[model samples]
Target: MADYDLEALSLGELKKMQKDVAKAIATFEDRQKAEARAKVEAFARDLGYSLPELFGTETKSTRAPAAAKYRHPENPSLTWSGRGRKPQWFVEALAAGKTASDLAIS
Candidate 1:
């Protein structure tokens, strides 16, 4: 490992060095993760299971799409799963003094 006299470096040099260090760290982390994953997969195979069989593969739609947890008051078609970002209709309804419970599909 080469020693760096960071204190002696100019602002531009320091910035460049910082960028280089970040790239190196990212590469090192990626390599480490790949190695760890390989080891785990190998162990799983030895135990008579593939990696996905051991860890479980991510399904495109996990356990069926989340049922609509919230629905628009005027439009039943406009619904939300209450998972990700609030929909525009949901936000507008809130702004219009509608509580989340008021929009429940049930």
Candidate 2:
């Protein structure tokens, strides 16, 4: 990380620095998603929801729905399972252009 010359920074420069800081924070958040998924999965398991019963992405459908119901591959029981405070491998997979049907439920 480069040191910011705080004394030399103008208002515009400060705004640019703020934007850069925001970008860095967003990047760190993206990287932490895997850790978040693991935490959610563990919590879901403790709460008595079998992962497979919730996510149910194992079966392949020839005529899959254009927008199938999203589930967390990690916890699966989460209400907003796609992406949010909680993240899932299945959601990440779909984002990477792989269908949910391609991943085996474990």
Candidate 3:
């Protein structure tokens, strides 16, 4: 709430102020999140359900494992889920005049 002449502050003073501001912001955000979580948990309890029961536990894996979509022709064991970056072998195969469809597991 206090007004600050930030432009007039020295470099060292500004850096210190920046650090203090960052810490304050982090603390404020944490406090706000905790308060919100408490309110949600209380409402869930009132509805005859625990917080985790209402909103599934964070420890549980939310996504199913990705299935293998592509496989190396020379070696059936070499497989790719086709999610992220293409593997080096896949790139080499493509460079050797092989179409992407040629690597399809199905």
Candidate 4:
């Protein structure tokens, strides 16, 4: 009823297939993580810890602000406040013709 020819796929079709395969792999990884979480929950029950006591979010530490300042390595003159997109100094340096290798993590 359905025609299935593996050899008839174009490059775009092949790329879509690769994307689908990657998504499937990611889904499998998520399922494995869920299974591991279930095992941990069971172990916590055996240890007499309440589910909330064992896995509650009541003890989370605050994350540091994203806008903390740092310097670029290759160009020590460039500084960045790690906020939204790429830093302005980095962009300006790139606009002035600098490669990614020209920047270092400071």
Candidate 5:
């Protein structure tokens, strides 16, 4: 790894580097999980069995993504799953006195 001259770098450059580092850290976990899963699958295959066969098909790792539960009133393309922090539009809708039911997908 190259040594960074943090004091000599501009604010924008430092911010960009911070963002890049954050992204790399996030992806590293995913890469590790994928590598471990691959190794386990390979081991299972050597024993004439698949990972799914040993761990069932409905494992949390293979679960489907949450379906969107609400959409923007003006833009149908923008949606929310009603999970985690609400989207900007969803928050604005609530501030404007629109209930969750008002924005719900029908």
Candidate 6:
């Protein structure tokens, strides 16, 4: 760790440094976990097995992007796939006497 003259730093500089230190502390565990996983994966590969093969869990995204099913009336560019939580505009549109069919893309 580098020595710092804490008294010389301005409030802004000190706050920024505090935020940096907090972020570093938070990500340190994640970096260590990734390193440990890498080491395990290397060892697994040498033993003719993968981590996923042993654990039966994939670390990759397999779901493809869903096509947009609904669009904003005023904003044609704004769209939703009709999955998950409804967007604010979509909710407001429903409250404004617009049916889901009205928002459905043709």
Best by lDDT: 6
- lDDT of all the models against the reference? 0.90, 0.67, 0.93, 0.75, 0.94, 0.96
Instruction: Name the lDDT value of residue 48 in candidate 5.
Output: 100
* Residue 58 lDDT (model 2): 63
TM-score, every prediction:
0.53, 0.33, 0.55, 0.44, 0.55, 0.52
What would you estimate as the lDDT of candidate 5?
0.94
Candidate 6 global Cα RMSD: 6.0
Worst 10 residues of 5 by lDDT: 55-64
Model 4: how far residue 77 lies from native, Å: 26
lDDT of 2 by residue, 21-89 (tens): 999999999879978878878888899876566788667779533433455555656334233343455
Q: Which segments of model 5 are wrong by more than 4 Å?
A: 59-106
> What's the C-alpha lDDT at position 87 in model 5?
92
TM-score of 4: 0.44
Best candidate according to TM-score: 3
Please report how far candidate 6 places residue 2 from its true position, in Å: 2.0
Candidate 1 vs candidate 4: the TM-score winner is 1
lDDT of 6 at 96: 97
Q: Tens digit of lDDT per residue, candidate 5, span 8-68?
A: 9999999999999999999999999999999999999999999879988854566688999
Which of 1 and 5 is the better model by TM-score? 5
Compute the lDDT of residue 76 as modeled in candidate 2.
54
**lDDT of model 4 at position 53:** 92
Residue 14 of model 6, lDDT score: 100
Mind sharing the TM-score for model 3? 0.55
Model 1 misplaced regions, further than 4 Å: 60-106
**By the TM-score metric, which is better: model 1 or model 6?**
1
lDDT, candidate 1, 1-106, per-residue tens: 9998988999999999899999999999999999999999889889999977866885665577888899888888888999999999999989999999989888
Which whole-number lDDT from 0 to 100 does residue 54 have in model 5? Answer: 95
lDDT of 6 by residue, 1-106 (tens): 8999999999999999999999999899899999999999999999999988999888676899899999999999999999999999999999999999999999
Instruction: Give each model's clash number.
Output: 0, 0, 0, 0, 0, 0
